[model samples]
Target chain A: MIILIHGLMLIIIGIWAMLTRKNLIRIIIGFAIVDTGINLVLVAIGYIKGKTAPIINDAVSTAQGAAAGMQAVDKVVDPVPSALVLTAIVIGLAVTALMLAYAIRMHKTGRSLNIDDFEEQKW
Target chain B: MIETILTIVLAIISLMAAVYAVLTKKTLNAIIASGIISLLASIMFLLVSAPDVAMTEAAIGSGLTTVVFLYALKHIKDRRSTHDD
Candidate 1:
């Protein structure tokens, strides 16, 4: 429960940085922070108190090999959210890379990293 | 009990680092602070019993992301120096 709130706080801080920072790189850092926050929230949501991971290891069952799969479901936390977070992490990396590439190209063309200097792209 | 304490500490530190990252004037310092946030977050994931996410966050989030940002900064610096010449 606390972790969920912490994640939301982080997301807010990241958004604040993104909105206020003038440097393009600073904004990218903010985006990365937001990515981390979202991942944390997803994992926190799947976590059940007093439950182990969804992996069916020896802890879930020892002697009952045949019924282990059936028993493991109730013993572990949800796996779907973990899987979703894994995908999100990968996608976040790709997006960060793409953003950084754009920043580099923009700096090359505009000759500045300051957001305000890119007036030609603004409305 | 220990896990709870650890979680609280990690959360506080990561929050402080995030604030410092945004408020700091140096881009390099901000990058390092963001890396700190990622590293601490991976630890937080471990506390939540998500070891796989923890490992991935530590490796890609803290490791690769920081390296990429540093490289990008270097590239920008190099270009500026050359352009000035």
Candidate 2:
């Protein structure tokens, strides 16, 4: 239940950020919000009740007489999302840095931050 | 049921922030409002068990992005002029 609420909240925030902010930087911030929301939803989907970390140990197999050891391994949380999130984080950083750098260059060339001021490109 | 209600409430709050950010005239205010939107989203991510994402969102999305935007803001002049119509 809590998970569902969290997911819904994330979606709402992301959509909102994407729609309304006018400044380029604000728009980028909106994209980040959307990214975070999506990551949240992905993690929520992977969650399991009463799950343990997925790890393999041969000694545990001998101690638990085989059956319990296999069961323990089966109960672990999914590792795929964890791996994906690491990749996403690095990507997010790179994109944000690039966006900020672009914003800086735009400021230098145009001398104005307003989106409307950049209309020279439209013609 | 409780979760549904919470979801609805958060949705409403986020929507309001979005609308406000859009309607606001000042670019700086809009940027600040967008940061609020990112912060809320990060919290939602944490609640959903994506702590790694939440950490990145909090640090890069809300923190570094805000700083960079402010720096850019400092370099550029606002379009509105005191003497203009």
Candidate 3:
């Protein structure tokens, strides 16, 4: 419950940052915040009370894990979210790098990082 | 009780950093603050029982991303300085 609220708060703050900031770097920062927030929310959703890590270790079960089988599943937390988050984290890094590269190019072409200066098409 | 306290403290740290990163006037400060936010988030991931995710967040989200941003910033500054000279 508390985890959900915290995750949601982070998401809202990140969105606000993205919506209000004009600097390209700041916008990228906001995008990272939002990315982290979503990852947090996903992990929070996967939490189950009193369960251990989703590993087949001896600490989780007494019957050597593989032999424990059904008993192991009941004691461990869900592995799905952790697996998914691994991929998400790497993708987030790639996206952030791409965005920063774009910002560098924008600065090169426009001589500014304010983002508002990039508007070549006028109303 | 202790877990709850830890979670609350971490959440406050992360959200504060996020807000500061957004609202700060200096671009560099904003970038650093955002990095701090990611650092705290990795800690939170550990508390939530996702050590693998925490490791990824710490390395890629907090560490690699900040370095990349710094490199870009340095590149821009150098180009601008050369142009001025």
Instruction: Give the DockQ (2 decimals) of all models.
Output: 0.80, 0.25, 0.77
Error of 3 at A25 (Å): 0.5
For each candidate in turn, the TM-score is 0.97, 0.64, 0.94
Give the least accurate 10-residue stretch of model 2 chain A, judged by summed lDDT: A53-62
- The candidates, ranked best first by lDDT, are 1, 3, 2
Q: What lDDT tens digits, residue by residue, belong to model 2 across residues B25-55?
A: 7767866776776676566555544566667
Each candidate structure's count of clashing pairs: 0, 0, 0
Q: Where in model 2 is the C-alpha error above 4 Å?
A: A1-22, A49-76, B1-12, B77-85
Pairs of residues clashing in candidate 1: none
Q: Quantify all predictions' global Cα lDDT against the true fold.
A: 0.92, 0.63, 0.84
Order candidates by TM-score, high to low.
1, 3, 2
Please, what are the lDDT tens digits per residue for candidate 3 over residues A48-120? 8778778776786678545788788788778899999999999998999999999899888888888678777
DockQ-based ranking: 1, 3, 2
Fnat per predicted structure, each in turn:
0.63, 0.25, 0.80
CAPRI band of model 2? acceptable
CAPRI quality of model 1:
high
Model 1: lDDT of residue A64:
71
Write one digit per residue (lDDT tens) for candidate 2, span A61-99: 434656766666656666677568757856876787688
Each candidate's interface RMSD, rounded to one decimal?
0.8, 4.3, 1.3
| Model 1 chain A: ten consecutive residues of lowest lDDT | A61-70
Chain B TM-score for the candidates in order: 0.95, 0.78, 0.90
